[model samples]
Target chain A: MERKLQERKVNNIVCRCEEVTEQEIRDAIRKFNLTTVDEVKRLTRAGMGLCQGRTCGSLMEKILSEEINKKVSELLPLKKRPPVRPIKIKLLAKKERESE
Target chain B: MNKTADVTVVGGGVIGCSIAYYLAKKGADVIVVEKNKGPSFGASGTNQGACPLQLFEPPVLELARQSLKLYKNLSEEIGYDIEYDNVGALVCSVDEKQYSDMKKHVEKKKKQGINVRLIEREELLKLEPTLGENVVVGVEEWESCGVNPFKVNYGFACAARRLGARFLFSTEVGKIEKDKDKVTSVATDKGKIITNFLVNAAGAWSPQIGKMLGLVIPVKPRRGQIIVTEPTPLNKRWRCISDADYLLTTAFDLKATEVSKDKRIKLGVAGVYLQESTGNWTIGSSRDFADYNTNVTMQTIRYIAKRAIKFIPKLKDVSCIRTFAGLRPFCYVDGLPILSKVDNPQNFVIATGHAGEGITLAPITGKLISELIVENKTSLPIDAFSFSRFKNAYLQNLG
Candidate 1:
């Protein structure tokens, strides 16, 4: 378990909500050469946290733009995930099943 | 008696007070007006008060980096103890695939002259022992930290006052009366505040304030919900979760992530809550476009709880005493803070559209506003942030 923490330290926690880390972010950035925050979120889950990257977006965008060498203004916010709030999976499934 | 100050700053939040304190320190007779009874009432007052620079935009990151230096000396400078901690921040991830992706981010951040780096799981445990077993990676920035924002904003206001900046609370600037191209007076709910210069640092209310001056600002409101927890000792050194997507939260380019976002199950960078010296763990946030309204919803609070629960097991037992929401001056059209001299208008500067990162950009924005007003020079480039950049987009979309 201690080893897990150590290994995770170097990895990027893309989604603090899920404890997603840096290595995930790097893979997503390179896998797509991500040009925006939304892509990073979709591919790596960086901004998918409790705060929804509200606190992290600026840093994320800064890190993304600086590393990607793209203009900061070019990045777009990740497509906000639905349920914009947490809903019970049972309720979610009921809604989806009903819609289906 | 000519009581008019050299500068009359509107909306006394962290941004306003930070600007006012600096101006007052520089020997300017400045006056700050507030709709609240005192400082630190809005988002600045309500924030989890994390001063970590890791959760910021690039331009804002640089500004935050600069402000951080001042933050270290803030207690001494302001003669008040601002609860700031530079314990470091981290963004953690799981899975081999996630780890590899973080590698690319590290390489990119390196190129930009930032100190962010990736650590393996073994090192992650060394940094924080309480993380769940599922945790595999953490992008760490030892340079980041947190602050007691209530005190920071309060200190800025009090210090600014002590330094000769005046405060007029419960006063909202309803109109910015301009003559030809220059602002002549700031008309408030109280009356006309005769002044020579105007600084529109009104947070979520900036767009309306800008329009009152007949100047255009692309600022809009986006609401965020936050939650605070009961005291515990699981604190780590101020680490923040990068949440890979948060690194590019504003990337509009289709090729960036390239997936049609309208279909994603979730979007946001998540967790990094360590304990403060007082033994409290402050965690947060959920995003909603509920528009300009600040209300705490059960759904948002539960979302925050589940999000935190997934990462830190200790959170499962902690008590969440409160949940609240604050409005960020969101500018969705273009990813830029609208800053430009009220074109052709002398001594009128428009500074808002900070969106979620207003706190991160507060110090530097204040510096830049001061530079533009006092020396007519900017500490950093202001072209991208020009309030006028949206005019073209606004006009183009008109068709």
Candidate 2:
């Protein structure tokens, strides 16, 4: 049973609101060295969805804290920039001459 | 490839987008270069989005009155749902002194062709039962409207694009390249934009853009913190309600204490609250010179929340979803925006510093700027908003 627990593939869905899986979070953490919930969010879409982290904020924090071996309080969230919500790339792009 | 434009509008806020839309609609090749990824990324996107006809001085009153009519059909004209909700706003007062002042304001606005009425406490209660018992009188502006700020901004950008206007997002203007006295082109992070006309609509950063051209634009960032409350089923149809004290604090008026003649009540929070169509209440705000800081402090948020609860007791039970801040492009000179052609740089036009009134005054401002660009004269009386108003102060400060 302990070996099976170790072999488990971290496929559990963490942020049900954003449909982000624990495997995706771990992969994002490994890929980007994410040490905060907001970092994981930017990388894996963990808490960037409808709930705005209401459902899985703490879970992401817990995973980050455990992965980094640091207090959750010490890990600050990602700095927010403009276009806070996802905007369409096409809408933001320059207009085409053909369309004109 | 070098992009060429007939007019280059800096900043992609509602003002810039509005200007671009009108300019393009008039057959001018326009390009709006925004540092942010999208329009309304500044104060335009973050404001209460109230289109009130009251509480404005003469030209602003006339401009807002016109803009209200423009907003009524802007969504239809632009083929976008700017979500213009035509709900009346109530300017409430809880004290006897406030009531008399509100009466004067209503009378003054009424004479300006605004549909305003002074409602006493009994009728105010009938209109807004959620208002606290301390309400004495209220001024109702039936023509006031609410809108989604993001949609108003992006809608203008999209409509402008549809009309052959080009928008360059995530592109910051680095320098204004000029030849002798005329603005030849605007150099951006991407490339140089060669243009015949240049408009500085950079909002809080308008001064920075002006500095690139050796011009003095006296606009600074006035920090305003607003709190959002989780949606409640109650107060869904509640019109916008606020304490009359907002007029004083909105400007950080030094004479507010002297004018009010009341020293007991602190003036920072005035119970300015508005509900959005999203069911959340976007309660606002505080006006302070934070020098471009948009950080939402716990102190200001707590102050805002406390005052909001005082005005509407039911908000006490509602939890806050989030609190954010936006820097209003406050003009220090006469508290009015600078909208005029630069005397030295003949082709450079400035349309900025609308401050909190940006959302309300965008359309008329756009039309006036376009008129200045195309016809060299606007129908609106803009003698008060000229660049020359700051000339003496500009020289004195330079000295």
Best by TM-score: 2
- Model 2, position B374, has a per-residue lDDT of 93
Superposed Cα deviation of residue A10, candidate 2 (Å): 27
Interface DockQ per candidate: 0.02, 0.03
Name model 1 segments beyond 4 Å from true. Answer: A1-100, B1-3, B55-57, B236-239, B248-269, B272-274
At residue B262, give the lDDT of candidate 1: 35
CAPRI docking class of candidate 2:
incorrect
lDDT of 1 by residue, B1-399 (tens): 334778899878888998888888778889898887556557776566665565565655576788777777888878877767776767776546677767877776677666887788887776676676667777777776677675677678778888888888778877777788778887777767778788888877887777776666776666666665555674454344434444543222223333435322132214346566666565666545576677776555555565566566666766554455777776767645766675756777777777666665666777778787878878777877776677788888896
Model 1 lDDT tens row, A1-100 = 9989878656745456546666666665664345667546534445544456665677678767876887778766543433455333223212223342
- Please identify model 2 stretches exceeding 4 Å from their true place: A1-50, A53-100, B234-237, B252-268, B394-399
* TM, every model: 0.75, 0.80
Clashing pairs in 2: none
Fnat of candidate 2: 0.00
* Best model number under lDDT: 2
True contacts kept of each: 0.00, 0.00
